[model samples]
Target: MAGNKQIIIAIDKDGYVKAEVSGVPGPDCKKYLSLIEEIVNGKATDETLTAEYYQQSTSSQNDQTSLNQQNG
Candidate 1:
């Protein structure tokens, strides 16, 4: 699980839903989109990935090690 996940949702006067996710690193934010879709019973027609989407999670970063370590 990512740290401090947050989802901000807004609906326009025309009933168009827009959702933004924060505090979640990497593609993990997509999970929240599914949750939002289930709640609203609607599918997302567009998506914009933020900088956080390209960032590695803390856990994944910590799990990586130099190849030299494998020979030890």
Candidate 2:
């Protein structure tokens, strides 16, 4: 019973499909979007970052950078 991820897809009369991924954060969403594009054999011509995308904390990013530097 996991409710963490959801992908909602819609198709128009012209056979255009739009997919939206919910419950996933910013950087991670890019991977899913790319996969969708590949599966659909289409290119994403435009994109807008939602507010949730910019809500990531600086401390988390800094921690990852610190870890990478230490391991590199």
Candidate 3:
């Protein structure tokens, strides 16, 4: 798969937890992050978007285009 994804989780000495998602494209990455949030039982206080976060896969783009054409 072109968009092979991973989530990295870490905990500090004070017990603060952090998670980072990589290799996922577009808004779909949030689903993985949300799963991490549930495991940590906390809301995100900050976020950093990577290049992949802003990149949409060709399949997703085509799906969106098809929907727009159908609705329009």
Candidate 4:
């Protein structure tokens, strides 16, 4: 149904399984991604996000440099 929150799981012929959940939007999507990885398979072991992958707007990006300086 259109009103239902759907979690669609798919498996390929090669035995690779993946899942996708609909209706969870924004930052919550990342939580769904983790759950999908944990449930479908362990294919998400090595994951990284690129600068372009960060779709949210923040006040500043310069703070990362400051954090690195503190660590050093």
Candidate 5:
């Protein structure tokens, strides 16, 4: 949660759109992918998750777990 969140988008001459998200750890970066798809009115044909995607979120790391509580 302390890191900066950034979405960098690039458009090619052939109208291809490419987006890269940085400073966001874990699967939270997927949210930005959805947003970019919406803005471009297109669906993603492929996806490649980075090392950060496998890392846990900083906020989640600091969260206290309740013994009797279920995640759902």
Candidate 6:
């Protein structure tokens, strides 16, 4: 299960409401922060990013070698 992530939203005790995302790559993970802004009618403003998420999205694409290997 590589490249898989999850986002969580909830309502807490204080009536302030809450949203928490988990299981996502770090850092750039916050790039998705705006996704939750619509909840609770925009009562909150903040975001967090972690390193592990930023590091996981790299894709290795070798063009000629891939074709050559495919042919072989």
What is the full ranking by TM-score, best candidate first? Answer: 1, 5, 3, 2, 6, 4
TM-score for candidate 5, please give it: 0.66
Local accuracy of candidate 4 as per-residue lDDT tens digits, 13-55: 6655545444433344456555565565444433333342344
Model 5, position 6, has a per-residue lDDT of 68
Q: What does each candidate score in C-alpha RMSD?
A: 16.1, 13.1, 13.3, 13.3, 13.4, 18.0
Candidate 3 — which pairs collide? none
Screening candidate 4 with a backbone cut-off below 3 angstroms (N, C-alpha, C), the clashing residue pairs are: none
Q: What is the C-alpha lDDT of each candidate?
A: 0.57, 0.49, 0.53, 0.40, 0.57, 0.42
TM-score of each: 0.68, 0.60, 0.64, 0.46, 0.66, 0.46
lDDT of 6 by residue, 4-71 (tens): 55555655454444455555544444544555555444534444443443454552111110000111
Ranked by lDDT, the better of candidates 4 and 5 is 5
- Whole-model alpha-carbon lDDT for candidate 2: 0.49
Global Cα lDDT for candidate 3: 0.53
What C-alpha lDDT, on a 0 to 100 scale, does residue 70 get in candidate 4?
A: 12
* lDDT of predicted model 5: 0.57
Largest TM-score belongs to which candidate? 1
Q: Report the lDDT tens digits of candidate 2 across residue range 1-72.
A: 223666555556565666666556556666676666655566565555556656653211100100001111
Residue 54, candidate 6: Cα error in Å is 8.1
Given candidate 6, what's the lDDT at residue 12?
A: 45
